[model samples]
Target: MWGRQMFHFLLHWMLGAICFGFLVTAFSVLLSQLVITVVWCSLVIGASIMQDRDLSEYSPTGSSTSKHLSCSHALCEESPNCASPKQPCPYTANYYSENTTSTGFLIEDILHLASSSDRGSKRLVQAPIIIGCGRKQSGGYLNGIAPDGLMGLGLGDISVPSFLAKSGLTRDSFSMCFNEDDSGRIFFGDQGVGTQNSTPFLPLEGKYTTYVVGVEGFCIGESCVDRVSLQALVDSGSSFTFLPDNVYEKVSKEFDSKVNATRTNFEGSPWEYCYKASSQQLLGIPSVTLLFSVNSSFVVDKPICLVYGTQGDNHCISCCFFEV
Candidate 1:
């Protein structure tokens, strides 16, 4: 079963890479905007009813912190949208909070939309989505932030790419080009794999699905590799890559030795390795080189130095691809 599935998956992507460019140009009407813009109030409330589940029942604790909500209006202090009893309450999504070991439930939802329509035909797209609908914790830091939804584009059947392909609107392929300002466009359909050095994303053994890639090791400072081999998940869902405790300690020591590292923390950040200065200015600072299989090496330098602050004074230099 696995062999055949892998064969077909790769086959479709190969065909998609070859034909997507022509399709985008010729049938411009098929080019659809790759985003979910909104969700109506009725659907949320109705889905809760339809599933026979009260969104309010599932909370991080056996109880809920939203007691401040007026039973008369059923509204919380933070958001007025879930004001009515008819409105859908957020679910307790588990493992959604990375900072703590709290347990939560999974909130599965659906997205219905039309792909980008050129001045021509219109096609509606329906996708299955797993939404993380809880705060980083039960309180202050990112509390009440879960109501706003997030879209996952992982290597799973429920992901947007898989949904589009299954719906027969396009091939199982997509590409993205982004700018330094964070503005970008995602090209779907026969977006070719640029260059022949493209590496195949390997399948993982566990229940959770992800695009696991084979990593040889990380080379710090120029292209020198200290010989570390491992498998890593190429998860775009995460803002920072996570490593095992021992491995993180080793890398942290090496990073400190290389660069005069200054550690800082945000009010809610879950990271330990942070820097106040830009990545370029760190003397003897190693350029992070990720050595993956098939001779695929990713070098990080510019984006490594990120400015993160409400007032624009803070900067952080972080690196990791979740390794095991």
Candidate 2:
């Protein structure tokens, strides 16, 4: 009877200990809830910090933070928007310097007459043209103004040039030599020979895309001038070429002896003229070449066929168009 009474006493002591443990656990949970309500506004951040999670220890600094801080989540951190603070800009000082990686105009990916297999190809047989200068996979296009004012080429019909061909035709280096005269206008110097405008065929890597190739050569005839550069646009959709004002005066003098050479159609515009140059004459015309410090020199030798007005005398034509 004394041993049975000792067993009941042991059971009572165990029950009391279990009740004390339950009270202490309930108090701890209430205190934790109160601390979180007073300290944190969100559950995830509060719980993670309280638990001392591993992700909470990470902190982005330097360019990593700067990149994401000012940008939206849509942009990639590796883009120029997120440039590393450690990497310096090559264009910080002189932007047009030789060491800088420059961008040029993207050219429209249209095949020339040499590559065409139809009548449209034959019409542009000797027109001055420019091919794309970069790879196809890269997102780029030809950007230029039609001096002839004719626009009909669709965006879908073009194709980028082969990489090997583009590389061979464009500047081999990433550097461009641009100069501004006292007038603050840009000038293109061909191997130290400066032109009033940007040099032809100097494809900047990023700035401009492939533009139409301009024609440069002496006009042959009665009133010919030796050094004339005709800004020519090769349009497969057109049947004729158009020249601006002062440039035409010099060219007309070469074709017709009676043509007046002193007339400037517009105030200070360059005279533009067009003449039929047979393939034989095109071969004889001095090769118009643009030499880039980076790559191989581009030479233009073609017989450009231009449209003449009903009056027959040199009249400024607006644009050249043909039936598709």
Candidate 3:
């Protein structure tokens, strides 16, 4: 069946795994959709070998099902360190974090996928995908940032979704939906429903590398900041939302002027706008909304998040805003 094989996967809050007969787990795997390349840490080259102290426990053993990709492959041309046609393809990917990088060789492996059929039947399919067998990592990777691996869902020929599409297994599209509990589902080849709200993906540097969207501005209750004209990346990998210093100042000032809660500081917390308030008081706080083009808006129903004390008690409400 053409374009009927829609792959599905489950997503946890901070961790997720794709079922491939066995599990391939990663830290922030589902949320790591912002990355441009799919890279998994090799057990032999994991944090145990690294000089850094912090590292993830999950690591997959080198499987016999995988084989090194030859440099002659068309995908090898995209590798920055492809040398000889007879050699294994080498690749290196850098992250937004300073000094963070994943360097390794490319390998071809069969991904076991489960798809639902038209008659509500389930079928298993095996598709070949190109993945980076990370032999070494630096910086954030050692600091618990996707220590196990990263399954990149960003636009690229080497990404898992792209490989599936090129193999004629499904359409070139995917969707990710996260619930309030942080659990979610990832559907490959899904075009989404007609009634769903949508926004156009803008290009970056003449190319679409990651999910970039144009923002008209932000709104804190009735007061709105119009024409801010911010182009932001829709990054689920990041735990907190970040804004420019100028924009952050404008937003923080507006929110502080309207809220009745007293501003206080929480030790060891990065949030600058912490307030001493009760659960009932938090409910009265104004909602924040991101204004987009074509009457589309993303609303944050709960802007104030609870910051717990050392004893695990709800001490204060903090606005999740990090300056970029």
Top candidate on lDDT is 3
Q: Model 3: how large is the Cα RMSD against the reference?
A: 8.0
The order by descending TM-score is 3, 1, 2
Which residue segments of model 3 deviate by more than 4 Å?
1-41, 44-65, 77-83, 179-183, 266-270, 308-324
Report the lDDT tens digits of candidate 1 across residue range 1-324: 111111000000101110011011121111112211111122243243335532232222222221222323311222343456434334322222344221222333444545664577877655443333333333211332222233434445535667577767778877766677745656566566467455566544543354455666665665453655555544332345455455555655566556665666666655555666554555445676667687888765532446566644444545432333
At residue 155, candidate 1 shows an lDDT of: 48
Residues 1-324, model 2: lDDT tens digits: 011111010000000000011112221111110010011112333243234432221111211211111222221122263355433211111111123111211221222222233365523321222221211111111111111111111111111122213334322222123234412211111123243234444222222232333344443432226554433322232223334445444444444443333232333422343334444433443322332232323443332333344534333322222221
Computed on alpha carbons, the lDDT of every model, listed in order, comes to 0.42, 0.25, 0.61
Residue 230 error, candidate 3, Å:
1.1
State the TM-score for model 3: 0.76
Between candidates 2 and 3, the one scoring higher on lDDT is 3
* Models sorted by lDDT, best on top: 3, 1, 2
Where does the lowest 10-residue lDDT sum fall in candidate 1? 7-16
Minimum summed lDDT over a 10-residue window in model 3 is located at: 18-27
